[model samples]
Target: MTHHASDIPDSFLAKWQTTTNVLAGIFDVPAGLIMRVLPGQIEVLVSSHSEGNPYEADEKAQLNTGLYCETVMATRALLHVPHALEDTHWEHNPDVALNMVSYLGVPLLWPDKEVFGTICVLDSKKRNYQDKYVELLWEIKKSIERDFVVIEQQRQLLENNAELQAALQRLTALQDELLRSEKLAALGAVVAGISHELNTPIGNSLLAASTLQCHAADFAVDMKQGLTRSRMLDFVSTVEQGAGILMRSLDQAAKLVGSFKQVVDDQSAADRRRFDLGEMVRSVLSELNHTIQGSGHRVHCAIAPGILLDSYPQQLAQVMTHLVSNAVQHAFLPGVAGTVRIAAQPDSEGQVVLTVRDDGLGIPQANLGRVFDPFFTTRLGRGGSGLGLHIVYKLVTAALHGSVEASSEPGQGACFTVVLPLSAPAPLQKPEVRAVRNGNFV
Candidate 1:
């Protein structure tokens, strides 16, 4: 009853035409029709081109007492009024007015028993219809219902396919975002380390410059008071010393700044180059001197001088910075004197072994294993983003194609050891970025 004639394929409609026409001719009926039922009316779906046929396709009729389909739909069974003219109720029906006094029909059904329509034959004169006529119409009804089943299943499959494609697109988007977040986290850590390293040399240079200016002003005043050989000699010595201090401080700052620029350039390009390991380590230590300037902590380096490597120096610099900074922040309490030692040498296996050891409050044994995990920090809400060690681990293993290990016991301090090939195996890909705050990858 809910079927749309336009939704039925032309091939299926052609088949329906053949079936209805055959049934009409075999029965010698005036009309053979398939009607689709609506809420309050019936419409002709297919009408046979039989002689004297009165019904046309798409013709609408009310579901009243006179209609043959109305009776078939209500009964949900065969309706065979062989002699409607003899029946009192049918004598005044609309079919009788149309000269269709005899009818044979059966209700068509969907699989769930919902009525689809009715298939029937109408004749102008009274005649008895055999049981075979009803059975043939029922077979055609079953065939029509099978086509509806195929359509419904196809619709469901199309819906499922669309949903699957949408889900895959969402997953790809999430993966892209995750890769970007990781790159940003690495970049943030580098910026933080550079900021801390620059503070010391720049601070010392500014102080020395200010002192030198004061000494020059005093020398100017002394000269105006008249010449005295002893005073002049003392003033000259003071002025020379002040100038030396200022120049030395500024030079140290300039060296640190040069190191920073080279490291940044190498990291951004991710290229392999020749570098002296000992000098690089010393430069990094110089930048970090401010961290231990007044904390009573001492830094010791035993790097083998002239030890050179063809590798990514910037990545190595970053790893060293993280290790040293971690010691300053976590290895010791404020004002507590401790020792952080860096040692590097070549191994017999063509690899370089670098160790950063700290004598402070050592890591708890239970926490040592998880130190390199991203966002895993013991100092949450107290200045730990927990990504420093994670970045180190990633660089050593992924970018440098190297290996690292950490060993510690509570109150005995912690030590990190790294072993990398003299030359990197391949150039690293661009880093995916994520947000970082206080050293935590977010």
Candidate 2:
């Protein structure tokens, strides 16, 4: 029968031998055997010294201890048998055919609070069993129990250590994910800054190109009509103007390229220094003069003298570009032009507020809050990465330690205001972009 010791972590078959010869002599048997009851099986640990047939170790015998150990364990009784062949409790056992006649078995209750098995003695001759010999077996059972407890405790300790190791692995994975998120946020902010810095010079070049193109078209007409000396000189003048335009455009372009290059290099390099905010914004807007005129929109700017920031300039450029471009692209529609005002002024407290105002189709109140969310774009598929405002938010909050807000009404136009801290922003542990942008119905 299945028993607790067979499956219990603390249970095991132990040989408690205290002079087997003396044990056999005292028990008046040929063999002194110890068998432990385990779950679904039994283990034979010790066998007595015999003169006749030696009982080999059981390799495949289930404790198959029917009601026997149960009765003795429940009652704590000593089993005394004169002859196994005639005993009603064990006559059916195959051991009866062997020279075994006397069977005295006692349940071993160890002192350490575990049941190792049962101790028994078998004799070829039928002999009356006694209590004194059974009492000696109990003493031996108690001794082995002490050792079992020590070993079992160690096994439990090992299991606990293994569990702790698994928990540490899980914790490490979570920490890695957190680190990755932080890096991605930083990357978004840098992109925003770079976008801002590029807008100005490119805009200036575009204006210069347009002015030269208009002048060249006039000279082209004169050349096509006739090759007069006056026309030739006029053509030369036109060529010189175009060359100057090209040179200016190229120079502005070089500055933009250099700025972008430094930003890219910083990704694989070390820390960068702060930049002049007022200068960067002013330089960028100079290039956009032509675009403003082409779109029939006027730009009114009031940049503070010493507005400055401590951060990667490229990322800050991106933030400004997205905001300004958004104002340009969506500022005017339906034969109606608008005014875009860019102002930067430091308050008495030294905090700088940059405002971009557009008098075009103002944002709807409902959608104003969601524009900055990643992948949330009102433009459908029209060159909108849905990342514009998202990138802006990331830069302002993460890199600049600044806050941005917008207010608008239908037909009244919209205004975006960003407030930057006077000093360098403290690094944040978990920087995330805020959602902004929506439709305003008039």
RMSD for each of the candidates = 10.1, 13.5
Q: Model 2 off-target regions past 4 Å?
A: 1-30, 38-40, 45-54, 62-77, 85-90, 108-116, 127-132, 218-442
Estimate TM-scores for all models: 0.47, 0.44
lDDT by residue for model 1 over 1-442, one digit each (tens)?
Answer: 3543325666767888998899899989989998888768888988999999988998888887568778888889888888788998778878888899999888877655778788899999988866776677788777877876776576569779999999999999998797567657645664565455455557776787777788778878987887689888887787788677777767766765654343223244446788999898889988888876756688898997888888878788888988998887889987688899999989898899999999999888887876876655666544454667777776776567688889996677999999989877765354323112312333
lDDT of each residue in 285-332, candidate 2, tens digit only: 776767666777677777766667666566566777778878888767
**Candidate lDDT (C-alpha), each:** 0.77, 0.64
Error of 2 at 336 (Å): 51
